[model samples]
Target: MTEYSEISARLAALSDDQLTVVLQAATAGRPAFWAVRAALDEMAGVGNVTPGTDVSPATAAPGVHDQVTGGGVSGQVGAASTVPAVPVHPAGIPDAPAPGGYSSGGVPTFESVRDKVEQRFGTAQGMGELDRQTPAGRSADEQWEAREKAARERLDRIRKSMHDNDTP
Candidate 1:
């Protein structure tokens, strides 16, 4: 009679295999559905926290437990848990690797990449690498001249193509 019952009838009509497929997909990409979350909690022996309910870490232990699979949760689960925090410096973060250019005690640095990017974009007259495809060992002035020539050539080609268009 009602919309809920009509939708229920449609779902009830699906075979077991079809229902399983649908439920699996719904559980994965469609967690907005409260029913799917409830079903997940039920299967995991955990209580269902309603959608939009703010269950902070402090209060979640009594009513609900995060059902984590694949091994088990050690200390990453709950608040007030004893887990030491490790400080990491910027130098500790691994940078883009260069074949012969690792600095700071073999911890790769970003200086090489920074230099390349700056050469390519930051400089006024440096070909940096790609401007006009200049051969190796070209001066910055030569590279800029080649880049300017390439731009003019490309512009001429584009203009020629536009004038020779068959459409109009």
Candidate 2:
């Protein structure tokens, strides 16, 4: 059979998705299926066919225009214009910190780190009492050891603060 018939048969056999891809490729200038269509028309002795009625002789193709004198069927072309610049502020307003930093009211400050730590693990003195081997104490030996280590660290920080103040 002829190449046209073979191509037509292949197109007929294409799946819907394949047909869509073919149509998109044809619409874009890449594969140029219109060139093949033109060739087929020439083989059938039909000259170039222009869609719809012709316009003024001075006009170029449908969307295309004569760029020589910067004037076309559309309009005259000029230098590309740019968008206006936005005003700048020197002292930028600070944005509210993220949700984790504030309560629902949109304020940004957080509780002191020591306050947060104490909230999570009671007071350092309370933790030291829990670490004691009293009958009422609830923590395991390892847990008590860990809590004692934390309490000692907190005490060291307090002592360092006292020493630094005395130096002045």
Candidate 3:
């Protein structure tokens, strides 16, 4: 007999409990087998076979109907359709409007740039607040110095270990 026929004959011989276990194993490995598992679970429930051990199938995969009708996936399905668009400024232009209605030939002054940065990031108070929040108050230069010192200390420790080994 062919493989299909042999498999069918074997399946036909399995008790309802054995079939339920096989269906659970198959569905657990692959979500696509969920539908078949669900049907088997319902059948098992009605037949009162392995009633205590019955496992319900996972929810169905999201479908086109879910997307259009907004019914299937709960919170994941019903989010707002469109996000707010980002405001755009003209090319080679800053996002802020020109100060005093005066354009300085499109070249922003250092003070203007500093003012803009401070406006967005706040004054020295902001920098102080950020520094206080961080574990170390050191700036970029201080951090680099700390890293260099740590590397040198590590190298010294390794050299000491090697010298001790050689002397012994």
Candidate 4:
């Protein structure tokens, strides 16, 4: 692509508003920011534009034409330009998380740590007092006592029902 400087003459076709949009985006170090800037400066001069306009292409000093795109817009795009310039993989879309955490400063990040550390004080169903509402069956000691009593009663009934085989 031709540098903005090479295309400065062509920019005259764009209206004042259009020129402003290009200038705003180009300040982020888009290729040919200097050329867009030069066009704006020329418009300001020819149209008797008021100083109220923020056309102060701070990246490009008056008469200091650094035609290189990345020069004057140093730090304009900042860390964003650090993203990989390669096209997205054509094979398939990446997973939602893309593996590591979203740290961009060379460090891979993991998902937010949300350990499901649960603590139960009294019962499994609910909080201490609330557990009483749920019928969780008899306690171990109570169940054992009830079971033993039933067994003894059953044995007595069986003894009464048994025939005296020794006597026979």
Write the candidate numbers in order of decreasing TM-score: 3, 2, 1, 4
Q: Provide the RMSD of all predictions against the true structure, rounded to 1 decimal.
A: 22.7, 20.7, 26.1, 16.5
lDDT of each: 0.56, 0.54, 0.59, 0.49
Model 3 spans with C-alpha error above 4 angstroms: 42-168
For candidate 4, the 10 contiguous residues with the lowest summed lDDT are 80-89
Candidate 1, which ten residues in sequence have the lowest lDDT sum?
Answer: 80-89
lDDT of 2 by residue, 132-163 (tens): 75654645666778999999999999999999
Model 1 lDDT at residue 54: 59
Model 3, range 89-141, lDDT digits (tens) per residue? 34676544357533445767667777788787777778878886676865665
User: What is the per-residue lDDT of model 4 for residues 1-168, given as tens digits with 9 covering 90 to 100?
Assistant: 234444565456654445554555445455657666656656535345665578655744444342222323233546343111222224464434433444444444344222122333224445544644446633644677899999999998788768544355
State in Å the error of residue 134, model 1: 98
lDDT of 1 by residue, 25-52 (tens): 4566565776875675555445745655
- Ranked by lDDT, the better of candidates 1 and 3 is 3
Q: Where does candidate 2 stray beyond 4 Å?
A: 1-93, 102-114, 120-123, 133-168
Candidate 3 accuracy as TM-score = 0.24
